[model samples]
Target: MPKVVLVGERELRDLVPLDRAALDAVRGAFLALASGRVIMPPILSMAMPEVHGEVDVKTAFVPGLDGFAVKISPGFFDNPARGLPSVNGLMVVLSATTGLVEAVFLDNGWLTDVRTAAAGAVAADALARPDARIATVFGAGTQARLQMQALALVRDLDEIRVWARDSVKAAACAADIEAATGVRTRAVGEPRAAVSGADIVVTTTPSSAPILFAGWLAPGQHVTAMGSDADTKCELDPAILARADRLVVDSLAQSRRLGELRAGVAAGAIAADAAVDELGSVLAGTAPGRPGPDAVTVCDLTGTGAQDTAIAALARARADAAGAGLATDL
Candidate 1:
C-alpha cells in the first residue's frame, strides 16, 4: 500500500488561494486542454430532487502531471434552512503512473470554489477589455462574492454592482465585497440597472429561467455566464448567444449539453452546428479573443474536470513542499 496524505480545508485554503499562482494553475489547465493532451470525460451527475440536491463527480488526466484528481461535489439548496451549508465535497488525488491514491483533500468544496473563481478570472482576463473598470454580478451567493474578488485580481475594477432576488442579501454581499476588495460596491434593485454601463457582467445564480436578456447588453461588454452548469439552469436569454459578436465556451461539448448554448440551440437562437471558440483555444492563441474593443463577447463556463485535476495537483505539490498534511499507509 502506498502512503496517502490527508489534507483538511484549513491547510488547503492556505495552500491554494484565489491569487496569481492559483490563476496560473487554472490557466495551465486550459492550455493543456487546448493542447489536446488532457483526457477529461463528461461529468457524472446525480440529481436528488426529493431533497432538492445534486451531486457531481468530475475528474481529468493531464499530460506531464504526476497525478490526477477526482472531485465529488454536492449542492443542497435547502441545507441552509437546516443550519448546514448548501455545498460541500472532497477530492482524491491519484498517482498517474501507479494508479494509486496519493492524497485525499477533505476540503469540503473549498478547492472547488477556488478553482471555479479562478476560471472566471481567466475567462475575464482573456476576453474582457484591458481597460475594464466596472463589473456587474448577478446572485448574492458565495460564488458571486468570489467572482468579484477573482475579477479584481486581473482587472483594475473601479466599481462592482450586485443584484439578487433577495435585496437584503444582495446589499450585504455588496458591502462584504467592498470591504474585502476596497472597491466601490453597491446593490442594484433592477438586474438591467446592475448591468448598465458595465464593462464585465458575470451571472452566478442557479436560475432555471433567464435573468439577463439580450436587449440589456451593449457593445464593448463581456459576459461570463458561470451559473448554467446544468441542463436545467439558464442565466442568459437564448438571444444573447445569437447577438454576441464572439461566443466562447469552456468546452464546446459540455456547453452544448449543459451551458447556455443548449438553450440557445433549443430556441433556434443559434445554429446547433455554429463554429464556436473554446476558452482554451483563445488562451492558447489558436482562436481569437475579443475581436476588438467594441465587440461584444460571451463565455459560457459549465465547469470542467481539468480544473479539478489542476488545482488538486497544485495543492499536493504545495503540501509536499511545506511538509503539510498527515500521511498514512493503508
Candidate 2:
C-alpha cells in the first residue's frame, strides 16, 4: 500500500521557518533547473466576469532522490468580495520508483508563496548589489508582499516604494508591507518613481502590456521581473534590455520563447544572444553578476518546477520529523 501524508495550511505554516536554509534550497534547485532535471508545465487558467481561476501543476525530479513531488495549485481569483485571498492551492508528493502517491500537502498556497519568495531572494542575492537599499515593487498583490519579505532576507533594505494602477491600492499595499516587514515602505504615484534611484527593482504585476520603461532605470541597478510567466503577460518594455548590462533568466529556453527576452527579440530591441548570462550560470560560479558598481542587471524568473520539488522535499522532511502527517494507506 502507498502511504499518503496529508498536510494543511496550518501545518505548512509550522513547516516553513524563515531562514537561509529555504533560500539555499531554492537557489541550488534553480541552478540546476535547466537540462530537463525538473518539469514545470505552464499554468492552465480561465477567466470570466463571474469566475476566474487557474491551476499551476509543477513537478521536479532530482536524480538519486527517493521520490519526486508535484504541486497542483488551483484557486479562484474572485473571492475578494468574501474577504479571502485570490490565490490558494496545494502540493502532492509521489514515489519515484513506483510512481505511487506518497503525500498530499493542503497548504492553500502559503508554502508556494514562501517558496516563490525564496526564489526571488535567491535571484537578488546572486544578481543584485550587496549594498542595495531601495527597492521598487510593482503590483499590490500577494506576490508583492512576499517578494518584499524574501528580499529583506537577502539585502539590507532601507526603503521600499510600491506602485499599482490605483493609488489607493498602492498605498494600502505599501502599508501592509511596512507593517509586516517593519521597513520604510511608501506608495509611489508612478511606476517610474517606484524604480527611480532604487538599487534593486521588482515587478510583480500581471499586466499584458509594459508597465516599466527603459528610460526610467539607472546604472548599477538590479531588476527581478516576476510578471511574465506566460507569453501573453509582460511588464517591462523590450527597450529595457538595452539598459541592462547583464540579463539573467531562470531558464534560457523558456525566456526566449515566453519571457521579456522574447518580446525584446521580437521588437528588435535586443538580439537573441544579447543576454550576457542566466541566473543558473551565475549561481554555479560559471558567470559573473553585476559586473561592476555601475552595471545594470536583470533577473527574469518564470516559475520553475525545481522550486516545487525543493519545497515539497522540505515539507515532507519537516512533517516526518514532527510526526504531524497522517499516513493513509492507498
Candidate 3:
C-alpha cells in the first residue's frame, strides 16, 4: 500500500510564511508555464448565482516535476453574513508518474491565499518600477493584506493606502497592516484618493463591477489586479487595460475567460486578437516588462495550477523536514 499524507492548515501555515522562498517557487511555476510544455487546462468554474457563490477547479502539470496539485476552491460571497469565511477549499497533490494521491492539503484556503499573493509579488517585481515605493490597495480582504506584505518584498513600500466599500472594515485593515508592515497605512473613503500618485496599485476586491478607473492612474504606475478570478467579478474598468502601455497576464486564456481582461474584451475596449504577453514571458526574459520609467503596466492574475502545484510541493517538503502532517497507509 502506498503512503498517503494529510497536511492540515495548521502545519501548512507554519511552513509557508508568504516570504521570498514562496515567491521564488511561484516564479519558477511561471517560468515553467511559459516554457510551453506545461499541461494547464482552462479553469473549471461553476457559479451559484442564486446563492451569490462560485467554485473554481484549477490544476497544471509541469513536465519534469514529480507531482501536480488540483485545487478545489469555493467562494461563497454571502458567507460573511452567516459568520463564515467567504473563501475556503483544499488541494490534492498527486504523483506525476503514477497519478496517485500523495497528500491532501486541508488548508481550507490558506494555500490559495498565499500562492495568489506570491503571484502578485512576482508580477510586481517584474513589472513595477525598480524604485517604486508608495502603494494603494483596493479591498480589505485577506488578499488585500497578503498582497501588501508580498509587494513589500519587491518594493521599498513605506506607505499603504487602502479603500473598501465598508469604511470601518477599511480602517481596521489599515491599522492591522500598519502595525505589521511598519508602513503608514491609511484608510481612504474614495478610491481615487487611494490611487492617486501611487507607484504601485493592487486591486484585491471581489467586486463584480469596476471600482477602479483608468483616469485615476498616472504615468510610471503599475497595477496588479488579483481580485477578478471569475467571470462575474471585475475590479478595474476594462478601459484601464486599454490605456496601459503593456498588458500582461498570468495566462492570457484564463484572463480572457475570467480575469479582468474578460471585461475589457467583452466590452469591446480591447481587441480579441490584441497582443497580450503572459507574466511568465516577462519573467523568462522572452518579453520586455516595465518598458520605461513612465510606462504603465497591468498584470491580470487568474490563479494558475502551476502555482498550486509549486506551493504544495514547497510546503510539503518543508513540512516533511519539520516532521509535520499525519501519515497513513492506503
TM-score of each: 0.98, 0.91, 0.97
Evaluated at residue 75, the lDDT of candidate 2 is 59
Sort order, lDDT high to low: 1, 3, 2
Task: Report the CA-based lDDT of candidate 2 relative to the real structure.
Answer: 0.81
Tens digits of per-residue lDDT for model 2, 8-96: 88878888754577788788777766434555555444444456766667677865456677777765777787898777878878877
Model 1: weakest 10-residue lDDT segment is 13-22
Model 2 regions lying over 4 Å from their true place: 34-51, 81-84, 272-276
Quick one: best lDDT, which candidate?
Answer: 1
lDDT of 1 by residue, 168-217 (tens): 99999999999989999999999999999999999999998999999999
Tell me the lDDT of model 3 at 72: 93
Models, CA RMSD each: 0.9, 2.4, 1.3
Which wins on lDDT, candidate 2 or candidate 3?
A: 3
Off by over 4 Å in 3: 49-52
Model 3 residue 90 lDDT score: 96
Off by over 4 Å in 1: none
- What tens digits encode model 3's per-residue C-alpha lDDT throughout 1-330? 588889899889888889999999999999998999989988888889998988989899988778899999998989989999988999998999999998899998999988999999999999999999899989898888999988888888878999999999999889888877889999999989889989999999878999889998999999999998888888889889899998899998889988888999898989987899999999999998999999999999988999999998888788778878998995
